[model samples]
Target: MSDNPGPDSDPVRLTAWVHGRVQGVGFRWWTRARALELGLVGSATNHADGRVLIVAEGRRADCDNLLALLDRGRSPGHVDTVVAQWGPARGDLTGFVER
Candidate 1:
């Protein structure tokens, strides 16, 4: 990963799994909206084990903000336990899509 942030900065890849009462609510939509607002590129999907998987690519600060937002803006009866990993940076995604 490069240390410098530039105009052509590559998008940082992040894969996060949100646990707890994340499903059955609008968590996925909420995530997608936030990602779009932050100009992030990736997808958010619901796992079979009552967890939500999110793969987002964006700037370091934007990614960090997403994590914080997820933690803070959880829906009622929503509890999220997230685990994230950084991957190779990529290009800007077209839009946030639910899958």
Candidate 2:
């Protein structure tokens, strides 16, 4: 089989819990923008314990790009750490949402 992934190959779900000064700094909005740009469908939600949860589903490369961006600390607020989990895509989310 070819090594390269086709148009819809390598779909996955990225569950990333972002820690640090993320809430109240337009972080979710920024995440939504980035996810939309990457053509990923998911939601960025704020937890009561000062953590931002990001769930993105799309091509593996695209999800990887988002994770890299989160780790680069170029977002709205300072990102101390990014805990990520990967799995098969559920294909339920529509557009990216900031919650």
Candidate 3:
């Protein structure tokens, strides 16, 4: 198998800040499950300011799917807004974690 991603298989990093009613509500666990399902690797960490930071590295399409899911209003907590930043994937993460 090739190490390089094909044209449509470009990898990316998705960093999303999820706001509102997300702390202590199994949000990170939910995100970890979804990320793993999508074959992504990263973490969903709780911020001191009551936000959940979700970072996932995988194919752009899979990452986008996860982002869409986050915005679809069906998560464990009520999500007010999701602020996202995208960049090239950094192959430094292992399995997804809830931190």
Candidate 4:
């Protein structure tokens, strides 16, 4: 992949739909920590539909690494699935927040 980050290239944005025993489990906190460690900015929140939605922005590699970590269930809970994608990055997010 081209390492060059074009002006139009927003940071790498990843929206993950994490499932399986994710609620009430500090999953958001764990994700926030990881995102920070990876120098990413975003937020993670629990959905009423019993799933967690994590939106993160950072370098492409960092985004991929975060997804890998999630897929490996490095967090406190189990991650049944991690649906991720790459898109135009955005402005510097104000830290990782829980919504």
* Candidate topping lDDT: 2
lDDT of 3 by residue, 1-99 (tens): 998768558779999999999988888889899999999999999989999999999999899999999989999989999999999988999999888
Q: Which pairs of residues collide in model 1?
A: none
- Measured against the true structure, the TM-scores of the candidates, in listed sequence, are 0.82, 0.92, 0.92, 0.85
What digit string (tens of lDDT, one per residue) describes model 2 on residues 1-99? 998868557789999999999999999998999999999999999999999999999999999999999899889989999999999999999999988
- Model 2, runs deviating above 4 Å: 1-8
The residue-by-residue lDDT of candidate 4 on 1-99, one tens digit each, is 988867543566888898888888888888899999999899999999888999998887788888998889678778888777668777767788998
* TM-score-better candidate, 1 vs 4: 4
Off by over 4 Å in 1: 1-8
Stronger candidate by lDDT (3 vs 4): 3
* Candidate lDDT (C-alpha), each: 0.80, 0.94, 0.92, 0.85
The positional error of residue 80 in candidate 4, measured at the CA in angstroms, is 0.7
TM-score of 1: 0.82
Model 1 Cα lDDT, one tens digit per residue, 11-93: 68888888788887788888999989998988889889998998888887798788788777555347656788887766666
Worst 10 residues of 1 by lDDT: 72-81
After superposition on all C-alphas, the RMSD of every candidate to the true structure, in Å, is 3.9, 2.3, 2.7, 3.3
Count of residue pairs whose backbone atoms collide, per candidate = 0, 0, 0, 2
